[model samples]
Target: MSETSELLSGLALGAFRLNGQFLQIAEGLARPAGITPAWWQVLGAVLREPLPVAGIARVMGMTRQGVQRIADLLVERGLAEYRPNPAHRRAKLLQPTAAGREAIAKIAPGHQELADRLVGELGLDQARQCLEALHRLSAALDHFTDHP
Candidate 1:
């Protein structure tokens, strides 16, 4: 194989494995908060402000339909609510309820602990470099995908 092909394969495999590892850690951290990893992910996307289901899906790297289903479930469970969107009538914005925020609050300590542990293992400089590299890689992929 060409060197570039081999490098791309290695990067892909590493990313897949890292994704699984992060999901496992998220599951563990979210379980005690009475939410699943997927739920936590959706909620985390809108923590700062309300968003339409499609926006949440984009932020969470999920499909709009999948985010819609989760948003409906969250509403049913009293964890979130739908508000009329100013931009679009049919597409309502989703925001976490007080209960939802509280649940996420419950996960913070564990999340921090895990973050600290990982940072310690990686060292602060290395962790920052790793994050920067990932960001650059993602941006490059986005650029290529959009252009191609």
Candidate 2:
């Protein structure tokens, strides 16, 4: 294999490894609030404002059906609610309820502490550069997939 192909393979492996570690961290951060990381992710997506099911799915990098299932659960558990959407009658908007906000608040301090520690280790500029590179890489992959 070419050097570029070998490097790309390494990048793919790194992404898979990072994804697992990230999910594990999310799981721990969310547990104290009595929510799974997936639930926390769904709620976090809607915390800023109400969004339709499809919108939430797009923003949260989740499947529409998966988000719908979680949204239903959130409503059933009193963490979220579906309000009638003026734009689309059938597609109601999902928003975080007071309980949802409270749950997220419970996790915020720990999340911030972790972030602070990471910043101490990595430095703010280095972290921002890494984030920018990741975004660029994601966009490049997206472009290639779309074109292909």
The top-ranked prediction according to TM-score is 1
| lDDT, candidate 1, 1-148, per-residue tens | 9999999999999999999999999999999999999899898988999999999987766899999999999999999999999999999999999999999999999999999999999999999999999999988887876588
Candidate 1 stretches with Cα past 4 Å from truth are: none
- For model 1, give the 10-residue run with minimal summed lDDT: 139-148
Tell how far residue 26 is off in model 1, in angstroms.
Answer: 0.7
lDDT by residue for model 2 (1-148), tens: 9999999999899999988998999999999999999899999998888999899887776899999999999999999999999999999999999999999999999999999998899999999998998899888787776588
For model 1, state the Cα shift of residue 113 in Å: 0.5
After superposing candidate 2 on the true structure, give the runs of residues whose Cα lies further than 4 Å from its correct spot: 145-148
Worst 10 residues of 2 by lDDT: 139-148
State every prediction's TM-score relative to the real structure: 0.95, 0.93
Candidate 1 backbone overlaps, count = 0
